[model samples]
Target: MDLAQFKEDVIQYSKQIGIDKIGFASPDVFTEMKERLRTQQELGYQSGFEKGSIEERTEPKLHVPESKSIISIALAYPSKLKDAPRSTREERRGLFCRASWGEDYHDVLNERLYRLASYLKERYPDLQFRSMVDTGELPDRAVAERAGIGFTGKNTNLITSEFGSYVYLGEMITNIPFAPDEPVEDSCGDCNICVDACPTGALIQGGQLNAQKCIAFLTQTKDFLPDEYRGVIGNRLYGCDTCQTVCPKNKKKDFHNHPEMEPDPEKVKPKLKPLLSISNREFKETYGKMSGSWRGKKPIQRNAILALAHFKDVTAVDELVRLMKEDPRPVIRGTAAWALGKIGDWQGKEAIESAQMKETDEQVLDEMRKGLEFFTENV
Candidate 1:
């Protein structure tokens, strides 16, 4: 079997299976990424959600013994929502970022990789490969960059010439040695847009991100969001897209290639009030398929309360009061109280004062006080 011909066939097959981009790369250690990871760790820049130690993450060979090459894949998602639902003053909405706009990307990419693996296995029964999506120990961006899928942008996103950075990346480490493609050689140059535009200044520098300060990471956290970033996240429910939206490279880069990648505008941009009271089953049925739901509804609900506060939606005051008084989770109760304060509704102020009398949790009581203080500060 001609290896070159086989590689060509694989590329064609990937396109047929709706893979937007595909490339091959050597399984050598990612030296530059290793140093960057080390630096990020030392600076306390890590997200804490990272899957593995620095060594395991940068070395592709650790996950796949006898790995000869890696196959990187990218699937472009819709950058703009079609017929998006409007967040009216009477009924405001919270947004999940474009990355979570459609069905869970991990499942979509895993299916693509599985199909590719099945095809390869049929032709070469001894094909040894380990597939990985975003959760894998192997760094997807490093592999994508090495495979010539795209260049790493200043925001630390993989920027493809065709799809920009609105793409989902996944990879497979295989024993078959495939010739690598040339890397894209474009730079952000003098553009400090994304770095400067970060809501929490999480970009620190160009490519270095302090995830702790990142609104995207903060939205996924189950605990109470820090006070400073409460207003920074704005209406975002899960994930932050400020950096991606500000990128010049991503201008007019919307791709609706796969039907599954298309977002239901109402679902992705659901009304904030509804989310506050969505039962477990309703939340599952409504958003279970989206990637943003992975952290479950706690964080999303907390963010929803914050979103209501962001809008100063007096319309949601009753719902926020209910959550503040009756929610089972302390984080939910406390965050709702804080949001009630931020919203500055007279009714919310009264609700917080009333709840404060019966609230036993110190944190929730503190939040109630903060909420009440908002009125005093204005007065």
Candidate 2:
């Protein structure tokens, strides 16, 4: 088999199958990333969503014993939503980040990887290959960087020349010894836009991130959002894009390449009030297809309450009151209490005081006291 010609064929086939960018990388142990992971662990900065131990994550040979090379692919997603719905004063809306705008990217990228694997199998017959998306043990960004797909940016995202940081990445580890491509020649060049723009200051000096403090990570958590970040979270329902949106590299880089990635304005930016009461069946039928809903409706509902507080949406006061008094989940009830306090309306305060009488949970009682204190402080 002509390995050189086969490499070219694979590149062309990847393009034909909707892969925006593809690159080859040698599968040696990721020495530098291993140290960085250790540092992040030591600092207690990890999101706890990480799938594997540091050794398993950095060592490709352990994952696929015969792994000789990794193939990294990037698919650009649209940055700007077309004909987006307006968030009216009467009915404010919450937004899902651009990354979760369409069908779950994990599904989309996995499908493409499977196709690539099948094509390679037809040619090499017995080639050993393993494909992975974001959830996999292997770090997709590190793989993309080594594969020369893009450069790691200050926002901790891979920024490709053609697509900027608005791209979904996936990889396949194979025994085939494809020649590695050169890393992209790009850097932030003293530009601290993403770092400076981070609301919670999650971006440490240089390129490291404190995931525990990141709003993107915070929005996905099932617990109550910290008081410091509640105001900063604004109307974001899932994920945060402030870091990427402020980067100059992503300017005018919107690409509507895949039909599957198109955002449904109503679904991605739905009315905040409706989200608070959305039934499990309704939430699943509407948002389950999107990646943002993976944490289920709890986080989104909690964020929606905060968003209403952010807007000071007097219209949502009744719904917030109901959730505070009747919701089964303590996190939801506690968050609703906090939002009512933040909104600072007479009825919201009254509701909190009434719930305080019946609330038995210590956390819920604490939240109710905090809610009442808002009015006390005002006087």
Candidate 3:
């Protein structure tokens, strides 16, 4: 088999099938990444969402026996929303990070990988390949870095020359040995904008992230948000983009190439008040298609309550009062109580006082007490 010719053919076909960037890499052990992962684990900097053991994550051959090469692919997503809705005083809005703005990239990238695999299978009838998107055991960023898709930025995202750091990455491990591509040179020299701009200071010195302190990770948690991060999370409902948005490398990099990747501004940046009471079915029907909804409506609703507090949206006080008085979920009810206190309205205080008598949950009662204390302190 002329492996070089096959590699060329695969690259050409990849472009034809809408893959923005493609690169090949040997399936060698990712020693550096393994060490980094170990360090992150030791420091408790990892988000609990990581899927695999360190060995499985760093070694591609374990995932696919006889894996000789990895093919990394990237699809650029839009950074700027074309027609974003305004967040008025009466109608405050919350934001889903850029990665979750459009259709779930997991599905989109997986479809592209399936097509590429089919094309390769036609020529090599005995080919064995394992493809993975974001959730796969193999680290997509490490694979893409080795494959020359992009250099890893200080913000820990793959920064492609053509698409900046806004690209979604996925990879395929195959038995075929394809010549590897040269990695792009690291280019974040003397730039600390992302670290400096992080609201919670999650980005530690030397480009490392403390995921526990990251607003992106914090917003996804189902539990009550810590007091320190509540104000920092701001209007974010799902994920945080402070690091990416502040990167100089991503300057003016917005791609609307794929129709499926274009964001519906209203959906991604919905009014906060409506989100407080959105039914599960309606939440699913509206945001289920986006990557942000994967954690379900609870987190989003919780964040929406926090967002209303961030904006001090007095108009949302009635809805918040209703949530505190009647919501089934303790987390939602407690968060609403906290938000109402933050909003500091007379009705909110009155509702909290009323609910305090009826609230049985210890946490909810504590939140109600905290809510009333806001007015007490002010007085």
**TM-score for each model:** 0.98, 0.99, 0.98
Regions of model 3 farther than 4 Å from truth:
none
Model 1 scores what on Cα lDDT?
Answer: 0.91
> lDDT tens string, model 2, 184-280?
8658898988898899999997589999999999999999888889889999999999999999999999999999999999999899999999999
lDDT of each: 0.91, 0.94, 0.92
Q: List the residue pairs that clash in candidate 2.
A: none
Error (Å) of candidate 3 at residue 11 is 0.5
lDDT of 3 at 37: 93
Best by TM-score: 2
Total residue pair clashes for candidate 1:
0
- lDDT per residue, candidate 3, 220-313, as tens digits? 9999998899988989999988888888888899998899999999999998888888898999999999999999999999999999998988
Global Cα lDDT for candidate 3:
0.92
Model 2 lDDT, residue 97, Cα: 99
Candidates, ranked, lDDT: 2, 3, 1
Q: Highest lDDT: give the candidate number.
A: 2
Q: Write candidate 1's Cα lDDT for 156-272 as tens digits.
A: 899999999999999999989888888878578889999989989999988888999998899999987888999788899999899999999999999999888899989899998
